[model samples]
Target: MAEEEQCNQFKKYQDYFEKQSDLMKKYDETLFDRWLHGEKGVIDQPPQHQGERRCIDFNCCHSEMDSTYSMYCQTSRVPYCHQHYSYTRYLQPPILCTSNPGINITTKFVHTSINKNKTPVYCMRWTPDGRRIVTGNEKGEFTFWNGLQFNFACLSGAHDTAVRCMTWSHSGGHMVSGEQGSNGSSSIIYWNPSLAPVVTLKTAHSELIREVSFSPNDLRFASCSDDKTIGIWDFNKQVCEIRFDESENAVYSVDWHPTESLLLSSSKGKVRIWDPRLKEKVGMFSPHKTEINKVRWNKNGKWFLTCSKDFKIILHDIRMFNKPLMIFEKHMKDVTIVNWHPIQEDFFVSGGANGVIYFWDTEHSKPIGEIPVAHDGAIWDLQWHPVGHLLASCAHDQTTKFWSRDRCGDSLEIKKYQGTNRDYDPIIPMYDDDLEQPYLAPVFIPNQINPSRINGFHDI
Candidate 1:
């Protein structure tokens, strides 16, 4: 019985071996036939043009080829290839500040984000928390964007005319905007973030408003106009408490002292410092041969800086009231705008019609650095970011640029828009048939000159 059982077990093993051999033969035949006929099931063919090595694994299909490999195959026409890819390199600009080290100016700058728009940007300001940015444009529109997402969170019409100037209340609860019209309907409007104007002060001016600024305390604000007057308004009372009419030309700019209860106005060619509490001009500084375009106070309020069409920037010590402590005369064209660094009181920036910007350090009495081609055309305005070391500039080229204060080497064109478009072609030259020498005596040809008639037309 034992012998019979052993023999049966051996037969069972032999039958199992035969079955395995048959299965192997069938799989080999099927694979061979498929390879020969090029009919493998849905082969993720290794993409042609992979420059070097081709993947041949049955499960690893060519459909998973990288973008570089696909592009290489399409452009090079190489079949079933793979190669190491190289990345394009860029030279980055300098960074202004970094936490790894204390304040240093030579760090590498990486552009974190960019915001674009279709309308020309007039002004930009960051909210107190630095989470949102507000921008005013020539279309009389105001837009707010969250700094991270670059999404427009709110849009509203802040003025009927072009919104020429804007200022945020110190409390960050609302903003004040001045427009370019002077009717009763054209008044300074104050609006909250909800797109609603909560206070509209209708103290009329005879011409367009040029500038508006909020006091450091936020309880008061000032607006100047081509009417040659500056109106100081009380926010709580919503009334023009004082009107300064000392300027002979339009008041172009106004700035409040950092700590004092004084206001400064630049108009014509003079800078006037006014005491709002006393409601009178405390002092006047006339150091420019042309119009004074901008005035900015230092962080400590002990001194202020002014720039003018004379291509000069003057630093004035408020206590002396005699002459400027320093004069920057390096600009080649009109100095259109100036701004003081928010963190460094002695450092400032100036922009000009020459499309250049000067980074000035007051202590050194010279420009620390210069950026040429800052704008495509004349720069109209500039402001420093309240917290970060960034500066914003706008120009007639219909673009706004941002520069790093800590890193003067880096700059970025932030936004661009179309300016006014006008047509000039006509059917024909209008003056083609008109007399060309009517304003001058015909060159007196010796024979054609009638001396007797010349005396009668002497007035011509």
Candidate 2:
């Protein structure tokens, strides 16, 4: 609905509309939501030809800035047409860190793990003692590597299809493997790590097993699959002790709580914490609006993070359980995995579709650092080096690259800050129609749009 005062100010447009009153009457004059919020208010000054060319993000259609348009919406960082951009140039702008110019840290990693085996590495794991590294690739082969030289100890093809996942039993004597592709294909191999299979479990699901996590004890393990099931396997008996096939969609990932009592498994849109002993779901919730590609718990198990297809990473506090502790949105496409720094509980890294890895802090919702192109294609997995600040990112690009930091910046001493939010209910938008071009006052307009009406808020 049009605000009354603003409707009266249309006296000037009324004359022009009179020429085409019949056709104009067909559509209501209510502005789009952006204009109603007093956003993109007219830019009063043309952006000076600054040569620090800003790269266009995927959200922008054009490869570069158009000379006719000034700065677009600063918050959304997406380009808009003349009509849309002209109205949203104002409202509230973000208050950047100024107490100190806050040191800008660069993310650099020592490239140590790229083993180009002509196939993308699908999964990776470290031995319990962190002495050996095992990786499964797209071609259904496993490459066991020595921890020091990163030399291959053995390369074996035990599965007929892509080895989708791998995990070691608590004793580190046996490893569980999962595979994908080809219906009714054999899956789930329990290997003794000498290039031999201990007990090969047949496919319970029609498709691939996305993940397998050995429970804290060697007696059991949990596996989630595309068949929409989470199975708790009794390793000794070589049978699934219990199976949860209730997910409405494909189950994508699985993990065991450190306590060993709760098994965490996730499907598209929801995460369920199950008590395998009771054969019941203890807690289940949709952590993100989009598909939850991976769920990882912090070492202490107090918090866990979910990476999503919606480019959202949410940290969940098990105590609160109702709402996310914080939210991070940065990736351009689906976020495949998230791994907390084993030592640094508050920081984590997420990588997805484009092999881009983002480093985030749980206390804040934005990425503090990023590796724009860590791989050539979709990054399928991320594992932090068991010992240091280094991280391993593997992708569909057929290689695993290790990133190690040479230097981490010292913490900044932040001072007092001001917030635009008031401790009241139903807060008002920073600027309303009345303040920008108050509805109470008549508005002036030219017959056509031009940079002549450009006002404040130009990009730096």
Candidate 3:
């Protein structure tokens, strides 16, 4: 019965596949169909060209296989059959976080969970209780890892294609995930704590889904996609309450304000702010010179960060939308992901395409500490642990890593103003004449009111 259902799902999209471009048709002929047909394990394919490197799998005679079907272990740099390569890659030592305490916080290497199928982890988040880390992967599956031991717990298939994005409600009562539209259909699946799908919204987007974010109240969530639309959904109704189609280009990322009704979506170089109450865009600004890959709101929602292909990360204050609060541009490659410290709002970390992870303090423009090498490939996602002592990152290298506090007994904590709940010093101090000036207030001169402003409105 299950096989029949799977075939029906495949057949439903058959016409869409048939209408694809010639390049896509070639992919369908070579690999796509076989993968969806439940073909698993190391595949043997005809070599496209002769190469010196051969599979290093024990006693395996398959040599010079097509590079598309075989890959070398990122750490070992030795070729292996797909199966053995995944095994070896996951066994490689964790990359440690090396840093000099600027704000007195740093991270060290922790254990990693192995994906036996070599399914690259695309998105991950710690359960609200911080007991387990759930990862959505390229295989449309979810793998749960024990938070303490950092070992695999279980796996569940959730989609028919890549699980592109996912988010957990603030209370952990609900979990939602979105998928790539490889079969001309994308879906959003709401799950229970046990990893069982409770509600499935098929064809949620016309193109690949980029992100799904839950509001702070958890009453509603938002999803954005390459279809150039954002959907506001009410999970109780399992329907899209509103669809935003103002973006002129493909939307790559979306995030809900941690404590507000505002929704943020990034398309090309611009970020637009939408208020669900208004059902229209309230503000839009171009923060980067190129495509912005990700945008995240701080827990307080008063500040947010955006990283882009321009190799820069900008911090913006919600009140001051016209200008950035700080611009951090130390990354040598395109910065892929930025995660704020769960407890220390003044500090955050970023991972780059060159595999370098940087620790930054908003008070300074430079990175305080860094992991010169965090992965063998570009980092796809990053999430700080709930309490802020640990960090988790996944990358194109086909592995997920954990990092924890590096030192045991140091006073590795930042101090903020007394009698205040804020996590940062609200005022910037200036250094002048060997003395720190807490305030350098700008002088202002009053100007006469415009005579044209009669009682209220101005007319052309």
Candidate 4:
């Protein structure tokens, strides 16, 4: 019986081997067919598998196998296992917009900041082309900045004391600056940007120089001081040709007529017009309740404007001196500076001690717009760009700001040509290199006097 049982077991093993061989053959044949037709097939018999070689640590169940192990896998899928990868997310950055507001929109404060140096900036002006800006500080420092860069490129010592006032010549080739000394010695220095003063005109003014302006026509320029004198200089001769001392108080402001050969000055609540050619006063008007602080002539030269410490703007017709054609009051505090638009005759701006700037239209007594808190401290000076719609202002807080009129009309256009760069083509060439020589005589003026008199009767 034992022999019979052993023989039966051997036969059973043989039968199992045959069955496995047949299954292997069938599986190989099915895989070959699926590969040819690009289809998948299922396996029926379970094959004997060896235990995997694992890492030394029993906690690790992953097998250490050759990189080629992936090639023998039945499935073509691969899995990645990282905590950060499973929870990954993505986002896009935000965009910024800097579009300007419309014209009808009210005046808006674009920016404001206090200068850290604490040195008061007295005067500020943009370059003729509007590419750069220049500022004078009370610490006797002058800084030049390319507006786009927003950083100063050139800084130099401009004077021993504070630089009181500055004006660019019509040609934009040079600039003139006035320095107020502590010892009551005020001097005007002409700068060529390449060398020292081409012309230095010293005055006997015992106080600070208040105002300086270049003539519309290129023959001369004017400067006024607290010494109560207005000095007119001949540009060619580089000397003071006429001095007017009609004010008991200091002459605070002076402006040149745009078309005529006339000059206007304000001092001690009085406004006086002078004919430099004849060296005599032509008109005098006192319509201010308080001290006159500033005077400005319209671009058309038909009228002039004056502002006062009484918070009023008086529009004076050159022909009508007894009464202002229009008187407008907008500021609650003293009006410190008034500037007319370079091209528009109807519009002007005024700044006050309350750090407010008002834009006015003479046709209407009310202000078109106003900027409150335009500066931290009192606004000392304000100026308009010669061509564009930019306004520059200085403050006692040692900061200067630039403002642009909110004109958003599609019809607004700027056309620039190569030859159109020269605005004022002098009938004669003027340059600093020719300063060593003497100046020729100015164009002769006809001696004609108007019949209008201040006392209502002509003395002549």
Candidate 5:
């Protein structure tokens, strides 16, 4: 009687796996991990035989012992495991802007500060459609603002703690946010386009989450934390696929490549590049003298920017990162925020601890224009309008400010001279003494490759 009951249990398990195999083939293998994790409310319970080693293959019904490679799948009807299964390959074609607004840089723009919340603003992002702007505050409220008029649209209680980081999916179908850790607990929430909470992933970290970024494909997203780890999460599954626990200190920021699987992360004075598929870091370099507050990728994916508490912003070309292509040292205080133009890839802006916002053109080492006092306190976040003309900034002063160029503003008047000098007269040649100096033949020095700067470049 015992043997008969055991045989019946095996038959039940076989039938369950056969049904799963059919479902997996129709949906693809990515769902397999989700099913295992019991996410999306699709499966109410975990598999029964926890101690048994089932085939790892998506379509497999046979046990690990049945396959020579330790995995058996119904599709192949053969022995296979992770070693034989291929990783998913993702391709991202160039998503380039067709129009160009040539060399338009000026800080003489109209501006206003809005105080929708009494608490300080910690993070902000423009909606994917460019119709609304969302500002997350210290009180965990998300205030929506009209993208054009900068007026309040709506507000929602998004979290129980301060919303320290937030990101919208590329397709605008979903949004994710994280809160600063308090009382030894932190949470991450997923929302729909209407700001309605879909899932509240509680106790995501014991320490604060510093940043959250979505991948180019929008299938996966990454989160970095004060816990000194970077987590790769599946968007549909809402499960952490991998945790990179290699950082020596707190991870301050993370950004995915605009068109590739590459990920950039910053810690204390150090930056690392990671390839998520291989589950390993591919590169490392120390570009800042102190803690790096942020690292961002240009839309073109050829250049990236890093801002540091060292009071400097350094731009690096992806092809050659051994040395920075340009370093802007105009900030009088710690550089806290950096933002790239939405349309003009060469133009970017940086905000400092001194409340100053400086507009920069990558072609020049100095800022193209300056808003000497853009805010009253440390600027925590900066963003550009979808059209790339208007700028918005939030600071610890408990206010958010919008800046736009005066259509008739004199571009020449805002053109700053290079180096430690302040504003220069456009009509007067500031380097007059250099005009009389003897001309020397330009030297063509070759760039040297520093092999030690990166750990695993071949994988990139």
Candidate 6:
């Protein structure tokens, strides 16, 4: 009888795995590791098996060889044994996750301050004056910085959750931040160094808010959220003046035209235009073919840029309102954000989920250069240095990198000047300053294969 009972129990275990065998073939161990560590949420009740079923981890102290164990991965929803559960405790970095095949940079980023205290940075913006920067983090904290120093006035619990969006007014002295709601409630928190909750608009949206923008005049602000509605708020009253309900899909980004009364929003693969003065839809643009991630009004506010999850960047002339002036498709992953160079009208930069930052010449619709591994993970936000060609980028890697123009290399030399002339010299012999040397020539790397070096000539 005892032998028969043991055989039946073993048979049931075999049956359970047999039923899941097909899906098991598609299971990825790396993905399983992410899910087990709570890196990804695959199911609602992912803690582990409950009740008399006991822990699925065979390493459990109370576990016996004959004990029953079962648990499901929330992401894969696949039943896994408990012993496999404790495997994460003795974590080994996967060999596959470490190798990064990327462009060997002739130009590289200079990693600056690493904010270890805050949760990963989500959004960032620079004051119009460019003297100060404000960053919002996943921990719902607001960190203000000047130069490389952290300000003493960092605001804690500014949002109670990740601050997904931040806007610094063009003329006003205040900043507005939007947070992802833990519940169905979302709010906007306005702050200045001196005041806490200078003004708080609670329950500003019915769901998590994705972005917020203060108008050019700072008299009004606009917000978009997962609730599929856009809210226009009156700054003085601290109340929503009106809401646009045209989009059935959640709005991801919104930007107020720099000099006009118009506002632009990206949602449901559509570009929406709203006339805040009249509180009505003025016009709409449909250049994007997928959900848009970000929209930005150029310096003059005449042209705008929009990037989408479809990996396309479209430049729209606000006056035309119907067609994209340029369509850029250099990104390999869904794009996160786009920013215009403060001084160079034709120059713009974009970052994507793959951690590549591309510098583009909008007039040509092609990438002029790139930072191959700007971040190890997706970049969340990018801000151009207010005065120079330096760019500030924040990413999922928990670091903010400041990239500067490589004045002596790559972009300026390789493509701009070199072209196809391997023999092109910076200084002509007639214009040579040094009479003894005539002109400077590139030094051939010692013992290295130099395609540009003449092997027959040897070394004079």
TM-score of each: 0.62, 0.63, 0.67, 0.63, 0.67, 0.65
After superposing candidate 6, which stretches have Cα over 4 Å from the reference?
Answer: 1-108, 145-155, 193-196, 409-460
Off by over 4 Å in 1: 1-119, 145-154, 182-185, 405-460
Clashing residue pair totals per candidate (backbone < 3 A):
9, 16, 0, 0, 1, 8
lDDT of 3 by residue, 314-339 (tens): 99998997699999988989988888
Give a tens-digit lDDT track for model 1, residues 386-454. 543445566666565544312211112211121100111111111223332111111212122121211
Model 6 lDDT per residue over 297-324, tens place: 9878889999999999988888786877
Clashes of 4: 0
- Candidate lDDT scores, in order, read 0.59, 0.62, 0.68, 0.61, 0.68, 0.63
Mind giving the per-residue lDDT tens digits that candidate 5 earns over 86-162? 21111000111112112233353343546555888989988876678899999899988777656678888988889
- Of 1 and 6, the candidate ranking higher by TM-score: 6
Each candidate: RMSD: 26.8, 20.8, 21.9, 31.5, 25.8, 19.9
Task: Pick out the ten consecutive residues of candidate 5 with the lowest summed lDDT.
Answer: 451-460
The deviation in Å at residue 103 for candidate 3 is: 6.4
Judged by TM-score, which candidate is best? Answer: 5
- Residue 22 displacement in candidate 2 (angstroms): 69
**TM-score attained by model 6:** 0.65
TM-score, cand. 2 vs. native: 0.63
* Candidate 5 runs further than 4 Å off: 1-103, 109-113, 409-460
Tell me how candidate 1 scores on lDDT: 0.59
| Model 5 Cα shift for residue 55 (angstroms) | 62
Q: Compared with the true structure, what per-residue lDDT tens digits does model 2 show for residues 1-460?
A: 5566455544434544455454343332332233346643311111122113222111121223342124432322222112123433221111211110011111344334555568888888877665567788978888776654455577877688988888777687998888896866547888885648877888756788889887777788888888888888888998888998765888888888876578777787888888998999989888777778998877787888888888888888888866989988878999998877655556677887977777776656666556776788998888765543345667888886655331111111110110011111211123343233221111223122222222211111
Selected candidate, larger lDDT, 3 vs 6:
3
